[model samples]
Target: MFTPHGPSLRELAVQALSSVERGYDLLAPKFDHTPFRTPDSILQAVERALSALGPFDHGLDLCCGTGAGMGVLRAVCRESVIGVDISAGMLTVGRDQEPRPAEPGPRVAWVRGDALALPFGPVFDLVVSFGAFGHFLPREFPELFGQVHSALRPGGRFAFPLPAPAPPSSPWYWALLGFDTAMRVRNAVWHPPFVMYYRAFRLGDVRRELERAGFDVELYALPEFGSRRDGSPRCRMVVATRRDDSSQRREASHSSLAAS
Candidate 1:
């Protein structure tokens, strides 16, 4: 699935054997040439959805490898856009690549930091991530979601696109199941294993966790992808809003105690 300019088999093998951060660093140069980068169609659909929801002041692209999501942010945000990723190499490549010509849109910056331990305060009005969830395990979901929530200002949004799984009886389903099974086996027998779990990302579980983290969550279908046999959405955009009242209540409680 890689282009002619993409990483070779041996290069991919070495990356697969390294830690996630190091692997991504090694893959950064050719990441956009590979099938692994978030598809352009998804990015365009996200831009369209966010345009309807926004006019945001500042936007953050979480785990923004090669800065593809930054393009989407620039389309809707007004003042500024920031991209945060753990891989310094990825950030370097992103920086070297020429961004789209500046216009009446948010300016862009790239930051090197872990998504789980983001270094920003509640300064962003919108946040977006794409194709990075597979790197995180199920248990990490809460902490990751918490970080995203913490990074956003009150009423700020965190959005991502999620595709529905192939039907259980379909060949694609079996292929993915087989790949996940292989990954499990590899991790079981390996050291400092890479964690990429496909089945661990369930939409229902994700929505519940987002709610638990004090986000008001909603889902919107991307009609360009079409629907399933059951007539359910084929792909959905998850938009979670950070709680304004939670912060307000905390401030009020602190003030009350201080007065007492």
Candidate 2:
């Protein structure tokens, strides 16, 4: 258990043995109380970075979860915002918890849909995701990005914060490495695997995949997170611009998310 309000250890173990969708459904109620929830600091930092780039007309929170990114969208996007996720349970929590804004902002729509088979046209000017990629296997990267490319209008951007990979010398690296190994072993013997591996989604590989998916990618350092000793950012935002070209179609590599 992460806290008194978070899921207990037994609950987590049960969720881990279930399918991804079902697992999230079980955790949906207490998701916000968990350390797994995207922290307010990260969300605020992302909003700060995006505000400089926009007055965006429309935005999508891919794998939206309990609608944390919805606030970010409301701050920057003018007309409307959409949050798409596979878990109905998660969506319910977001819908019921909608904050009454002091001033009315973007029209919020929460849709139940798969990120891989997104139910939208080239409708969004911006797509933002917070802390949701680890649920996907690396093999799904191409198809996942393809969906994001299709969802965005021409010249639209797919933006999400990416924390730098832990260095091999850091304790975090070994911790994540061990966690991933345990997950692999669990899934090997279990039916309906719960996929959550921190190290599996490599940023270097992700950047290459995004380019392949026809995105002109850019990385922006999130100064709020400061920098590593090597002067690289502790966290960076990946801003992948969508381009529509027949030649560029095999390209675009990208999420629908689990809450984390």
Candidate 3:
């Protein structure tokens, strides 16, 4: 559901017909007013979880639309924080709307770049992405995770909040299923397809992909979102840390000596 200031039905229709980048560009102005932007509650919950893992230097907000996740980075990171996104329009809004925090925070910057082809070296200590996974297909997980891994320094973390899958009995489950089905149909009939599927990003598959990308994955339960009937966390923060380079080299050296 959208607020009164959110994108109109006709505006949303036009955006849906365009490419993902273009659609977000068109929606950027009113994004915060829409449910699409990460809620403050979720952001606060993530911020709390990440605070214990801090004080990081040089943080990145991947696919950082409207700079919502950037706020979390500012609170936890000590040095500079960057927000990278593919939509120039979204970046512009973020630049113009970002406020100076009361407490001294990291220097903030925005860059327009595709998530799959991030234009950065292993410079960041932390990277956080919120509500941007649906734009990526299941097959793109390898490249996406690989890019994040590459952007992070050795032992740096790629963190994100992942909500538990909705149960079949819940209306949310059916709604999300129908939405994905509709998106598939739209893509089938349209050019420059807008990819967003709610059901595609599975935890088991994601953990495996993160592991394959050279990350030691850890899941921290976000108690703010509470638990499911099975007593499992309803939401979790996936903290995937790249291994230490020194430790990696030692292991490699040991392997070479053993082989010789």
Candidate 4:
């Protein structure tokens, strides 16, 4: 659901018909007002979790649309922060609209770059991304994680909160399934595909891929969200630390992205 100030139905329709980058560029202005933006509660929880790990320096917010995840980096990191995204329009909005903390904080900057082809060297100590994974297909996980790993200093972390899958009987599950189906149909009929699928990124595949990418992966339960029927966390932050002295070897430069 979108707010009154969020993109109108017609505007959303036009965006959906465009490429992902162009669509986000069109939606950038009102992104923060939409439900699509990471919620304050989720951000706050991530901030709290990362705070316990504390005093990180030179953090990076990967795919930092409208800079929603930048606040979390600001809370825990001691030095400067950078927000990297593919959409120039999104980066513009992120650089302008994303506010500094009322208290003193690190210098924040935004960079426009592809996730599969990060421009930075191994310099960041921490990296966080919120709600951007859907844009990447499952096969892109290696390149995506590899890029994040390459951008981080040894022992550096790549973190993001992943929500548990909706129950099979829940309407939420059916809704997401339908949405993915519709996206598939739309992409088949349209050019310059708008790629977004709620059900494509699987947790098991993600964890394994992170491991294959030389990350020592760990899952931290976010207590803010309650447990499911099986007593599992409703949300868990996947904290993957790049192995010290490990070099990034996997390359997806020529990998084809399959539509899910």
Q: Stretches of candidate 3 above 4 Å error?
A: 249-260
Misplaced by over 4 Å in model 2 are 244-260
* Model 1: per-residue Cα lDDT over 1-260, one tens digit each: 37889999999888888888898999999899998889999999989999999889999999999888888988898899999999998999988984667555668899999989999999999999999898898888899999998899989999999999888888989888998898888888877788877777999989999988879999999998999989999999999999896686897899999999
Candidate 3: how many backbone clashes? 0
- Residue 123's lDDT within candidate 1 is 95
Candidate 1 stretches with Cα past 4 Å from truth are 100-104, 246-260
> Largest lDDT belongs to which candidate?
3
14-60: candidate 4 lDDT, tens digit per residue: 99999999999999998888889998999999999999887799999
The TM-scores of all predictions, comma-separated, are 0.92, 0.93, 0.96, 0.92
Point out the worst 10-residue segment of candidate 2 by lDDT.
Answer: 251-260
Candidate with top TM-score is 3
For model 4, the superposed segments whose C-alpha errors exceed 4 Å read 100-103, 246-260
| True-vs-predicted CA distance for residue 69, candidate 4, Å | 0.8
